[model samples]
Every structure is written in structure tokens, then in C-alpha cells.
Target: MALTDLYDRASSLLERRFLKNAFLPVAVFPVILSWPILIQSGRLDRLAAWWESLSTAGRIVLGLAYFVVTWFFAAIVASQWRNIIRLFEGYPIERTPLGQRSADWHRRRRTEATQWQHYLEYPDEDEVLPTRLGNILRTAERYPFARYNADTIVIWPRLYHLLPESVQRDVEDRRATLEFLLVTCLFWAAFGVADFIILSVTGAAPWVACLCLLVGAVGATLAYESSLSAAMEYGERIKAGFELHRGQLLAALGLKTPGSLEEEKRMWRAFDKFVRQARPADMEQYRRTSAPPTGGA
Candidate 1:
């Protein structure tokens, strides 16, 4: 089975309300996980006290950091809630439409090309995005959905347009990954800070504050994870690139309205046959993604 299928199975299991409720406690395991690190470093108790004293603005900043940290996990749960989430293992293509998928490729490519036009075009703060993105885009254009706007394509030519392209070509798109993880780390940090703050502000026993904070932290962590899973729409886009409108692919592969079980079965086998041979990652034969999406056939 494909990664999408595996994700479907896992999600099906998570759907049982009892399972999700029981699993909620693990969300706050981050607190426990950080115990050794923070305790050995002696930052946990200090943070707890600071949270008690933080002004509303400081709290708000910490809150935002927490949100950022847990976004991906939240996005996944929300997908279950909205019925729009489809986990294709680690890829994003499974969830997006072909048109939008194509558009993203076009947009990324254009961003790539623009930086190459001149030295001034190079962004001072960040290196070009399109070039690194080109690896995935180049791999995706194989399925027919890779077609999109021309203006977008001219920007990121490929992994070999210029010295800059070749140099940045192998770089991984880890910005999203790092940002997601950073926010997750911040969330637990805020909990420890809150524990200290509550004890100081309310004159509560330190142990009592910890117990209350732990429960709240767990609930908050899971809820936040659910929300992030909903918002992190990247992996879906990756899966969409691979699947490429199964209906259209069905037609393209020469299967039509089925009249019998035998015919449908035959077509299914044929799809598997083509899939094994023409996987988009194959990259050698179908190197081109979208040739300006010609106006006519």
C-alpha cells in the first residue's frame, strides 16, 4: 500500500473517541521529556517563577511560540476533524488539487528564475527558494497536473540555470520543519514558566502548581497539535503531486466506464503496472514539468 493508505489506516484507528481521549495524556510528555534537560540545566524551576510574573504582552509572545511549535501535529488532527486531511506518509501532494499543485510549482519556479536575473535580484535576507524547490517540482511535473501559469515557470528554470542554481540545488527545504519544531519546544518552555508564575502569583504550593500545570499543559498540547495538523497543508500538496487526479489518470491509462468486475479488475492491474514503471521520482524520461501550458492541444 502507498503511504496514503497507511496514513488512512492510522487515522481510522485514531478516530475512536476512546483512543484519542486516552492518548491525550501523551501530548504533555514533552514536559516529562524536557525534565532531564531542564532539571540538569536548572532552568525548569526558574522558568516556572518567571511565567508567574510575565506581563500580558510577554505571555502573549510565549503563547505564539507555543502555537508555532505544535502546528504540524495540530494540523494533522484538524484534518481528521474537517475530513480534509490525508496523510501520505511524509508527502504533501496527496491532499491538494492538481490545479493548485501545478500553480505552486509555477510559483516556486518563477521565484527561482527571478533571483537569477541579476545580482540585485538576489534577496539580501534569504537565498532564493525556487532553486531548492525545483528538485521537487522537477520530480512532480511528470503527472499531467504539473501544468500551470507560464509567468511562474520562467522564474525557476531548473537546478542548473546558473552558478547560484547549482550551488543551492541540493539544499533541503527545512525551513518549515525547523520552524515547526522550534514552536513545539517553546510550548513546553512556556508551561514550565507558567508553573513558576502561578506559584509566585497565587502563593500556591510549588508541588500543587506543578500538578495543575501538568494537566493543563497536556490538554493544551494536544489541542494545539490538533489545530496545527489542520493548518500544516504542505504534505498534502506533496501527495497531490503524486496521485494527480486518479480519475484523469484512469482515463489516460485507457480505462473507461466499467461494465463488469473483470474489466475493472483488469484496469486496476494495468494501473499498478504503469505505476511501477512510471513513478514520477523516475526523473530521467519525463524531466519536463509544464511547458508553459500551451493554449491548444
Candidate 2:
């Protein structure tokens, strides 16, 4: 098959959310980041002249090539979305001295902040992460465990399947917004570094290079701060999802729903243990009297 046809087929297989959250940012970043550099280097005028000289067929071919290249980059970025999230979450950072120092600073700030009133978006001081976004998300991940003894990391995927369609959409939309902001933050930070290096190497006006760097830095900072709020909203949706659908999760697992909050907590603890350890004995008392209904029935 032709390359464009292959691109079409592959992109069609991805969901709309993936394209919005993963593809659009990657596709737009180059154009946004390159404009100032092109202008400063006097390449913009030459590029325009070159474009005007192209035949109709050449223009079409060039546009297609650009689209394909951007699409390929977007695909790569999309594939790494999970890893990017983990990076933003500051996982495995205690090994590095800088990371350890950052973690300690954030821990102290969180401790001071929570001394007066508990913030929903703040993780426990002991569990504090190096980044604000990380701590916000960690707080959400720990919510179910703290309140109901349910291990959210273990239960969330199954709980998501049990959520109503409307609830699922709400959760997915919030998560997509958070991811978009994070990706934008990374792009702008990269743009700042690349723009500074390229401008310095090309001997562009010192003021111009500094201005571009400042713009990029500001954009990155704004995106990162916005991502903190997005993370909190996404976390709230996760909390709501567990609150509203956890019983459905129990039912889906062929377990009986508990009648009281205390019973529910105990049931969740047992279920979590059974899931993690494959210990059927722990869940024996929680099993439903009747088997869960099958699709064909």
C-alpha cells in the first residue's frame, strides 16, 4: 500500500480521544516553535518565496510529506504517553540526589500546608512526590484506599468497566485534558531549550534569542501550572467513579455487596487481597449466593 494509505489505516484504528490528546500536540508543536526562529533567521521570507515558486503538484506533494512526518511523530508520542505520565509523576526519583532534594522540599511544603486544613489534592507527607502534578494524582490514587480500604490501582480498571457510560465519558474527558496540558508543558520546555541552542549557534541577535527563550519558558510554566488544576479535576472524577461504581465492581466480580460502610471496607480489603495474591479463601464469604449472569443467558 502507498504510505499515505497506510497512515490513514493506522490513524483510523486509534480512537478520537487518542488523536486529540496525543496527536494534536505533537503535530502543532513544530509549527508553533519554528515560526519565531524562521522569522529571526530571515528564512521565513525565503521559505515563502520558495513555496510560491512551487508548481501545484509540488505543493501538494510537499504538504503530504509534512502531514506524514507529523503524523509519524505523533504516533511515536502517543505510544509513549504512559511513560510520559510516569515521568511527570516523578516515579523512581529517590535514587537521584536532585530528585531526593526536590522530594524533601515538596514534603516539607505539604506538611506545612496540611497543618491547618487537609487539602484534597495534597498527598500525605510521607507519600509526597517531587512535582505538584504528581502529588495531586497520588492523592487521588490513595483516596479509595484511605476511605474504603480499596486499592485503587488494583481496582480501578475493573471499576471503570462497571461505570455507567456517562460516568466513563466524564472520567475520560478529564483525563484527556490533563494529558494534553502535560504534553504541552513538555513541548514548550523542549522548545525553550532548542530555540536557545539554535539561536546561540546561528549568532542571531542576543536580544532575539533571549526573547524567544523567555516566551518558551513562560508558555511551559503556564501549561505546567494549568496541568496541576487539570490533574486535580481528573483526580476528582476518579474519586467519584470509585464512590459511585465500586459496588457494581463487586457485583461484576461475583461478590455480594456489603450492607454497611464497615462491611464494605472489609469486603474491599478482602477483594483486594484476593486479586493481588490469588487467595480464593479470603473472598469465600463475599461470594454471591447465585453466579453472576452470563451474556448468553
Candidate 3:
């Protein structure tokens, strides 16, 4: 089944309740960030002694860090909530309407053109299909509920939450895989930041902080690369499904099945790039390209 069908099968109750109450958490997020203030407000008599033990500057620093951390989290939640709303509202995963070009069409074409050329030059279908699919699947995971958007991390959870139970397992697995990579990236980045701050404050060796930063960057990069690899794995897993409905998939997109894997690769490269670039008015032109030319009457 196409992704559209899975979206249709999502739980209405979950969608309604989640969307209705999502704002509540975001609205109250400030309270969580204000724990230090709450302590000073005499709300926690038991911890008053402990709170008082901290120097004024220490308290201020801790409070500010808390505020920064929690606010950052709140922003992420709010962004994700917006994604959920868009999903429930029936946004297309790929925003470029069939045949209509997007603003970034040329840049997108330039990137995919390289991949298309690689596929054409290589005769390894088994390897190429996964590589191509992986890229596509990864991209899809990053931009759930929209064809184009900047909110590109941890999107699998939101998308998974929308799937019907029957389809949830597969999506959940994908989510888990992607989430692990994302969390790994965050973990390294956070540790590096924390280490840098601690080292700077203590006047400890600056080299240690620099080393921590480098390690964190490397970890994040590895995680990112792993995500792309995993995405390719995901694509391979779904390629059979795509093949099952190949005709429908191609027909809907104004594409034709290539006579050979090489041709298929070329067609897919064009199709992928074109879908991102084509304007609505160009839809007829695309259709005619794939259609048999009529004989002269």
C-alpha cells in the first residue's frame, strides 16, 4: 500500500486527543524550566537548606542552564507538534505538485543528477537499488507529512504514531532505528558542550575541551552516516512493495517502467528530480513523454 493509504488508517481517537492537548504541555513547559525559582519561592521547604548552600552565582548559572535546556526541549516539542498537526491536516509528503517546479528545483536536480549518472555507469542493480532506496527512505523519514520542510529530526515518532496498528510495527522499527541514530548524535553533542563548559569554568586544560568537541563532532557525523545507511536498508526492504505496485506508482507520477535496470535507474533519477522540480502546468508535458505517440490520422 502507498503511504497515503497508511495515513488513512491511523487511529482517529489518538489523533484527536493528541492534537487537542499537545499545546497544554508546551504551555506548561515554563513551569518545568522554573524549578530553581520554585525552590526560592518556598515551595520546597525540605530542599530549602540544600538550595541555600549554593553560592548566588552558582545558583544563577544553574538556573540559566536549566532554562536553556528546557526551553530548547520545549521548542523541539512545539515543532514536532506542528508536524503532527500538518499530518492530520493531510499534507503531502512531497510538496511539489506533479509537474510543478519547486523553488529549489535546480539545486535538487544537480544533486540527483550525480546519483543518476552513477547508477547509469554501474551495472550493479542489487547494490544500486538499495543505495537509491536508502536515500529516498531517509529523506522521507526526515520530512514526514510534508514534501518539503526544515524540521527534519526525530520525525519517525510523529509519523509512526499516525500509522494503524497493522502497519505500526514496521514503522516503529524504522522509527527506532532512526531515533537511535538521532539520539546518539544528540548525546555526543550534549556531552561535548557540557565538557567544554566545565573545563572553561574550572580553567582546566583547553585542549581537553577541544578534544571533547572533536570527538563529539565525529560521533555526530558517524551517526548521520549510519542514518543514511539505515535509510538505504529501509528502502531495500520496501523495494519489493514498490515493485508490487510498480505500475500504479509510475502511472500516478507520469513515469514509465524502464526496459532494463539501467533504464529504470535513469528513469527513477529523472522521476525523483522531476517530481521535486516540475510545475503543475508541466504535468501534461510529462505525461506525453511517457505516452506512445499517436499515428497520423
Candidate 1, backbone clash total: 35
Q: Give the clash total for candidate 2.
A: 0
Best by TM-score: 2
In candidate 1, what residue range of length 10 has the lowest lDDT sum?
81-90
Q: Across residues 196-274, which tens digit of lDDT does each residue of candidate 1 receive?
A: 5645465656675676467557655654454343323332333342233333333333345435545544444444444
lDDT of all predictions = 0.40, 0.82, 0.46
Ranking by TM-score: 2, 3, 1
Q: TM-scores across all candidates?
A: 0.24, 0.89, 0.36
Error of 2 at 95 (Å): 2.7
Evaluate model 1: give its TM-score. Answer: 0.24
Q: Superpose all Cα atoms of candidate 1 onto the true structure and report the RMSD in Å to 1 decimal.
A: 18.2
